[model samples]
Target: MKLAFPALSVALAALAGAHALRIESSEVAPPADIRGEHQELERVWSVFSAEPLEKLHLAVPGPVFVRYDSSLRPVVTPEAAPTRGSAAGSQDDDESVEVSAGSAAGAVKEAGSLGSEVKEAGSLGSDAKEAGSLDEAAQEAGSFEAGSFESDLLANVTSHSRRLRAHKKTQDDDKEDDESDAPEVLVARVVVTGNSSELLNMLELLALKKSSNNGLRFHLQNADATAEGFLLTQVQLAEQHVLRHLTTSLSSVVDVAPRVLVTNSSETKVKLAVQGASGLLVNEPEAITLRDLDVEISGSGFVQLNVSSVQLDGKLNVNLAGSGAIALHTPSINASEIKSSISGAGALVVEAENLTATEIVTAVYGVGVGSLRATTRGAAHKQKITIAGAGNVYAGSVVANRTKVEIWGSGEAYVQVKEKLDVSTAFSGNVFYVGDAPEDVRTSGYFFWRTPVQPAAEDKYETHAAIASPAVYPEHVSVQTKQARHSVDPIVKKISVGAQSVVLSSHLAAVAHGPNALLVFGCVAFGLVAVGMFAQSFQQRRARRHYRPLV
Candidate 1:
């Protein structure tokens, strides 16, 4: 029985050893769902597995779930357990249970309990599947995470705050740049409309950089102002603070029809130079210095200057009823001229070098140091003309009228009278004075002398009437003796007693005489002789009678 027992025990031991628990062709069936949620398991396997899980695709399927220990380690199953009452139990039962317990404890140390491992493996597999699905969806949607998972989540709140800070920083940079690049405009045009006062105020604002009050200052850098197409009723400028550096240039034509006053109080003085087509209607005084000023005035007004002077390098056309004067140092009417054709009571004084006039009427009066020439074509009945100068006087003709014509000069004066000349002057030259005196016309002077020219008898009444009038003689007259002289010709009948004696040569004759004594003496002598003859005849008769008979 011992021999039999030993052999049988050996056989039983061999059988039990051969049937020990072991994994036989372990195969992991894949779970039905595999996605990003299962990626943790994959990562765990990557950590635990010696080789890539993909290489073990044939082995690991579903979720790598299989009969496992607490550590999720693959559990090897025994081929067969010892029968309950078999001789192997009594021989190896304790060893087999002890081995199993050791294996269980090792698995617990590595992976935890079996239930917990199963749960974790399943969750990891699910998470991996979800991650895969999300990746696929992101690819399909054409989107990407800006950062990694943790980074993407944190960027939401933090990125907005970062962006806001960056935006503020950019704004600060822009402001810094703006401080260096401020914009500015060089020149601009402006139009102003209002009354004269308003217009003047605007001009003062632009030119002087202030309003009516000179105390205020403007912020503008350069003050240059101009005006056009403005109608002013009455405008005046402040006399104190007119800007001297202001410049105005016309872009178009302008017309100003009001009283304009321009004054200056600055030490440098203000100047206004105008060009283009412009007209001014000045009812008051306008003081300015003109360089190339072309001004036209159509109203009856005057332009008075209170400053140094006014110069015209251009033309001025004025039609005025009042008088206007120009104050100049060396006043000259240069090549640039002025035309003043005013008819109604007006006077123009040009204190210049020279003045020229075409025609002047009777109501016009002018005074100048230059030359004055006048021509008269119409008849004047009783005209009193006076011309006093060191210059010469020239006239065309003088008719027979009660006209007083006086020409006085320290120089030589040549006078030609076509009609009767009644002279009263101290003339120096041997005047070739020729003219017929009518019966009522006479010539008288201080030294009265005339060439002995025979009087024409055909005008006897005119000659006699002229001689009979004592008031019609020239005062200072000295006649030349070489010429033919005649006195009391047959054509001259009557003679006056107190008439001035006139010497007549043989070429000249006197036919009339006053009463003399020679003729009276001859008449008395003849009468006395006739009376003596009568007495002698009477005495002879008496003697004869006495001798014969007493008679």
Candidate 2:
């Protein structure tokens, strides 16, 4: 029993050392461009923005796609009124009033000039006026009274002139309001034919400005001042079964409604951001570079991104809070570092080279599964994974130099190690690895066990990076499996050889708590006692057979 104590403690310490790894600088910088820069493209834009006519012409170097923007409602214009004649009559009335006002102003000016001349003459002849009779002075006084009447008339003329100007301004303002109330006419219909392309080619030579890539992209939006807010109806096409080589096909709908259609000229890559329950399909035969992008999916939204190689700015963030699905597969991802977390029922599958992350978390609230196929070049590029709930991470295909893992619940992690693996487990959580065992380990748990087994068969859906695509999982299916079986391939693999007979077969230990721990220790003690008794009985039988009665 004392010997068993030393053996048990040594085994627990080894299990602790088996699981040990860490990641540095786990923060990912936010993307700078979500909805790419907006710029107008020449020639192609006229087809969407020009006034509706019976005929329309357009051309492009590549294939063209046209779609109606359902988010934009038709603009309803008010009926034209019979206000042309009334406006003309008001202008005529204003002109007549102006003429009469001008005549009254001229009479007032002439009367003022005569009054000034008389005052100057009266002042000049002061000596003569003294010699003159009082009668002459009385005549001059009468002329002064006449000048006062002219001054009052001038005031009345000025008042009349001001009234006429106010009336004219009021008429002009009413005319302007009438015109403004009239609605504007936007593109209502378009017709594209073979000749349209020829016309576009000719226009490009004549008026088109030299652009970087000259690649054109069309945008359909609302004609109202506020271009965003309404929901866009998306029509999904049939799924393609072709693998490795995939293509995107889009259909268009045309309607006689007022909408704004703008065009953008792309130079290198397209920056895209998708929100709500939207589906995004990205298929590029050549390498694709992305910077500053964000995507959020709710409900049944999904994203299928396949590229040859991808270059990230500084950070890439993807959140699947609902049952949404995301499949990001690429040959290589170039970046300083990356991090990811899954907290919903959704599934995320990723495959790339040298995939380093601070920690891949499967939160307590999460019921999803994550599959990662990555390779680290050096020990400094080690990865970390944490399983806190029922969420599982199948990283058996990942060949890492070092990995650090933590299991806080019943969740399990399958990893492939090249150098070292550090683990800490609580509750019923377990850690499984297939590679060289660690030389030293320590654990805080009471009981620990390690088993060796031959590698399981490869999964049919397994690729270089993922066990299976998220698409394979049916909608609303439970992420948890009934039992760990190799038949599923993705979740668990069956071991062959003599190691297969073991109930718990792996390279690491299983941590049990409370009653479970007591039960396991009791079984181990009983097995040891039974073996000791059997050996003693065999020895006594041999001794009796070798010596005769007393011997």
Candidate 3:
């Protein structure tokens, strides 16, 4: 009875092993047809592979979202290598290249002989050009004597220009057609959800699999049973560094638009260097290091920017082309010295309602408009504001101690001065201020408009007009503000991907298979019988040892 129980257990264990092999062999690999539109990743992985992936590079031709989450565990699968047949084929190719080396050397010698012949031909052509010049001189003398030289010269010039234009037109058309025929790489949206340690590992993986050819696809998602996270491939960076500098821009060729969001969840201070994409929204960080803030606006190119608590230590450059609008909102600004140069059809709004600065220097060029709503408390606080284009500087709400204003174009400056005000106006440029005009006023072709009474609260500064143009805005800009007003938080959906296969506990299906299954069962039975016989012989020896020892 004891032997029978042992045999039964061994048979059952073999059947269970076969059943697991069937389950693993039957599941399908993940699909590759992931779209460019944004999709959120599932938070958890139910049955994950134990393969540890260090890093991931996503090279999909679309926007990618990378966020930090502490709840997820690290689960990855190692990439499968190519088969032995492909490796053998590569070796054969190397041998064939070595065999062709002798033939390639012979071709090189023939090319050298051809180059010597071409040099001889070039010398003969130069001699023929000299003879042709002598004939042309004789022809020119004859035409001068015939008194129709000017008319003939004009006709030749006209014909030559027509031929050049036709050739240029053909070349332009060919260039356009070549550009049109080029393939458009599909933009893929990839979201990576992991903590800082896993994120660093992903960076390492991208470094290993870097290549010029865009053939391979890499994904960074928790390994789920259904494999819903992997949709597109990733790109590689040269080296690992702190995730500080980031650029978000729309591709001229790819149809997918660019959108970026950077939010600091930890209490630690973070620095950001942003290449201002149109729809960029950044939350307020404690200490920020921003340099060369450049935005190019063309066509319907409009950008809405809101950054708070700025300490001006770096350069801020804003350029506008084709009537594109930019509304920059800064709530508080602290600067030791401020210098601003605005040109083109750009508009700038510095909402420095609580601005503390010792010196503010501003120069406006082109039809650029600027509005500064600042309050300077100290007596040493001074402003040097200059306008050269048809632009306007509406600083009527700026209460400065001493102000210097210069206008060269049809520009205007509205100021609120405390003690001394210096104004210089040329052409139609004018300075409109409340309070008596100080003695240091110079006007060359225009007159100053000084209001007798202080302006009303509503009429302190002119309202901006660029904000109303093409109001289709970014989601982050709208969502953040709306939620703040209503005191309502946004809801996040937690999705768990379910397993696609049936869970089978019974091993009968594995054991009922053909000859291989029966053979495995027979082996298990034989092993159990051998172990039982060994145990029976050991018991008989022990019984004899106990009786003989007593005698």
TM-scores of all models?
Answer: 0.17, 0.35, 0.37
**What is the C-alpha local distance difference test score of each model?**
0.26, 0.37, 0.39
Question: Scored by Cα lDDT, where does model 1 land?
Answer: 0.26
Q: Tell me, by TM-score, which candidate is best.
A: 3
| Model 1 Cα shift for residue 361 (angstroms) | 15
List, residue by residue over 310-416, the lDDT tens digit for candidate 1.
34444334332222221221222331333333222233333322322221111111220111111222122332222222222221122223323322211112222
- Report the Cα RMSD per candidate: 61.0, 30.3, 36.3
Candidate 2: tens digits of C-alpha lDDT, residues 1-551:
01233434443343222211111111112223331221111122221211122111121111222334333324444453435544224433543432233232233232332223334444324434466533344445663353476555655665676568668867965764454333222222211122122222221111112212111222221111111111111111111111111111110111111111111111222323222233455544455444423333333345666666655554455555555566777767554344555555666677765454333432322455667666442112466776655567767655556667765545667766666667765555666665554343333331124321223344112243322221211111001112323321111111111111112232111111112322332354345445545655666789789886763
Residue range 1-551, candidate 3, lDDT tens digits: 01233434443443222212010111122224432232222121121111212122222112233332223333324443433433223423543432223232233232332223334444334454555543355466664333367646755775676568668867964553343233222212222332122221221111222322221222222221121232222222211222333323221111111111222222222222111122233333342333334433432234555555555443344444333355555556655565555555556566645666677676666576777665432222788887765777777766677888877656777776676777765446767765454435444323324422222334244344323222111111000001122211111112121222122232211211213322332354345445545655677789788888653
Model 3 clashing-pair count? 11
> Candidate 1: which stretches are off by over 4 Å?
1-301, 306-311, 321-335, 353-551
What TM value does model 3 have? 0.37
Model 2 root mean square deviation, Cα atoms: 30.3
